[model samples]
Target: MRKKRIIKPLMTRLFREPHFEEMTNEDEMDLKKQDISRSYHQNLETFKSIYSIPKNTDIKLREFTVRSLNRRAFIIYIGTMVDIKNIQEGIVEKLIQSQQPSSKIQDIVSYPIEKTASNIGDIIGFINGGITALFVDGDSTCYLFETTKTRGRSIEKSINEVLVKGAKEAFNEKVIDNIALIRKKIKNENLIVESQTITKRSKNDIFLVYQKDLVNNELLQEVKDRLDSIDSDKVLELSILEQYLEERPKSLFPTILYTERPDRAAAFIEEGHVVLLMPNSPSCLVLPATFWALMHSPEDHYMRVPYGNFIRLLRFLAVFVAAFTSAIYIAITNYHVGMIPPDLLMAIAGTRERVPFPSIVEILMMELAFELIREAGLRVPSPIGPTIGIVGALILGQAAVQANIISPIVIIVIAVSGLSSFIIADVSMNFAIRLTRFLFIFSAGFLGIYGASALFIVGLFYLVSLKSFGTPYFAPMTPYNFSAKDLLIRHVPIKEKLRPGYLKPKDMVRQRKG
Candidate 1:
């Protein structure tokens, strides 16, 4: 008996699935690798099989005879994605009504053909991007027509980065419109918008907007290399792509500046900075961001020198108040009560006489409550959000004081800290400040003033050491590069002449020395 005595299991079958699994994967790969056929019938059937036509209702395939040429033709597109009017009027109607027998397909069609593709893979990509593809009998190439339906809200006023003196318009979700907005600001021929496909599977495109004449080639290539190195199958937004491009993902401080204002993006481009734009993201990413950039508002430059500098000073003060108020209170009350005047000390002691918790515990409890109120304010419905925040804080604080769970002085400390944090407009910087506030509070609790001071020094060192795309985080300030002195304050617009020296821009002079 040949094999009846001992039938052993195959190692391949025992370790994995049958060989048919490999064949199935190869078949799927072959579908994508196949070339477009010259025969209209064969191309039609292949697409139908690949897209699973009957099972997939949205993949529309319309077959018809081109009466003018006396040839068979077909158009395929996503039903929901393409414009029905463009398909019916621009393509089908124009193709069938052609009077000249010698007319080419491009000449006969009323709509402009965007591109022609001979590969099945490229043709499918065009169709998937809301484009209509036309194939005729005996023709290997497919004509692509742009029939993508524009679906998004119209441009609206700036909401998050609201400015009283600057442009009221903000970027919408449409990338074309966003590009248009930037173009509207910078009409120079050197303003280049280069597009690249960064992902493998999803094929999402990112537009890099910069002035070719001004942007340093090395810097631009470095940015391009980082973007090209992303191996993700899908990256849907600029926000998600920002994380991929960031060198320090876990750092509390943001290395990129995100802005919804096209004017801001345009200004950065003028300064030889690269601005990244993507679809579905209302904001654009400005790379090689500095600490001052994140802290700045567009309105700072929009206003007069004195007014702008005044607000800047206030904002500067607010940052410290927000980050240090709770920690200072914790340090003084817990470890060094002598720092307070006699009257203030007696008042604080009197307020805490009825309270049962230590200074740190009381401050932490109030801070947690304030954070909860602020978070709830953001998450609740728009109509009732402010109401919930106001009423919730009032009731919670009053009840806590009445119940002797927290001191009135601690409430004042936490309230000042919370209010100061709101003065910071940038969301990322605000979060970093608030989080650092907690760290300082814990440090001060452990070792009083010395701990907070030590933490501050360490943080300063970290900030100075951090780099965004090879540019120092605290550039044009520490390790001093010649800038317009626009870091903490603003000079008159006419006096501000230099592009940031640390950027090492190709053109250092913004406005030639007048």
Candidate 2:
């Protein structure tokens, strides 16, 4: 019979709270130098200790043998992270059924990603990435198989930036699936997708995707240098990386574009823009965003030239209304009242005869109420979101008007301005427009038309000064680049034979006469 040996006193003496001050530099170095042992048993024990295997129910370690080679082997993998079907059919079944003795590792696994891991760090990395590790009893090396099985939502229509015509599918949370979508769109050999590890602790994979031939060497080098300089321990999402990657982090306008649709990202890649793809993020980042790119939508490409131009014009007008309508109304009411027709002036005066507050105060109050309603609608569940907006707007506006707290005309102006803001497709740019609107409103309140006009001119100067990755933010408009066409106007598809000359692409001519 085996004897039970109790060493409670020994255990008490050996295990205790660590004292950091007592540890020497050499001891710290020794701790850091720990590596995988050559013996299979030692390596297995190390993994168990590291993962707390017996305590951790999710980690499964199965011991088996290659009967053909007469060697003992064990498979260590996370049950939830790996594909069970692949492990069963690809590894276990094949190994069990092979009658012929095989000494080569390639005979066992035909996985394109099969790799030999020598150290504990490599083994841990492979296991963490949802790969199964095969540790043989005699050999010092271990084999890794990519059996990752990540669950994600199926491709669905884009909730934001929706279109009546164009690709319906948006990017999901899976990075591999996103890359596959891009590859499917652009099958050219020059479409390069390079994987890079950003964070040391998490070892998050970030992909730099771009066309090798079309991408400018300087811009590519700059991107690489910036990525290389990131010294973060963990980057949880792509947006976090974006903040670090941005040239002017505090700028009001977004220097880089973010897109949820694969078609949009692929189109930008074809235009010589480098896209940064991060794991777990549904959106991809497009570098060096231009003013035109921000305003352009996928629907523009789907429609014919004239129709597209018409839509673009309407969108521009919507932006004008969103940003300047309230400000212009305030300016005209306060200082430029002469500009209004006598009939309209008499009607406005008659409506405001009941209200005691100034025009600016009433307008601001209604705008704030509208913003609150917008927030409440956005925060509620999908089915009830729109319902909340409609009910709240109707009740609140009616009540405020009945109480004479705000003028009916003020409500109309605020509602129209808020509605116009929704026409903007890009979320970041839309937010910028909203912020700029607030500035214009305040300016209009102070000095009427003069304040608003001065602020507008200053904003234009600031925009012209800003650059996105060495490309001017205003681009062809400010610098007067001749080769680039279709600014504020959409030309026929065939007429645009050259790429944007301001971008300085290697091959400018997109189409030749031949």
Encode model 2's per-residue lDDT on 361-473: one tens digit a residue: 88888888888998899898999999999999999999999998888888889989999998999988998988888899999999999999999999989888888778888
- Candidate 2 segments whose C-alpha is farther than 4 A from its true place: 1-35, 96-99, 110-113, 482-484
Give the per-residue Cα lDDT of candidate 2 at 362.
88
lDDT of each: 0.87, 0.81
Candidate 1: lDDT over CA atoms? Answer: 0.87
lDDT of 2 at 146: 86
Compute each candidate's TM-score over C-alphas: 0.94, 0.91
The number of residue pairs in model 1 that clash at the backbone is 0
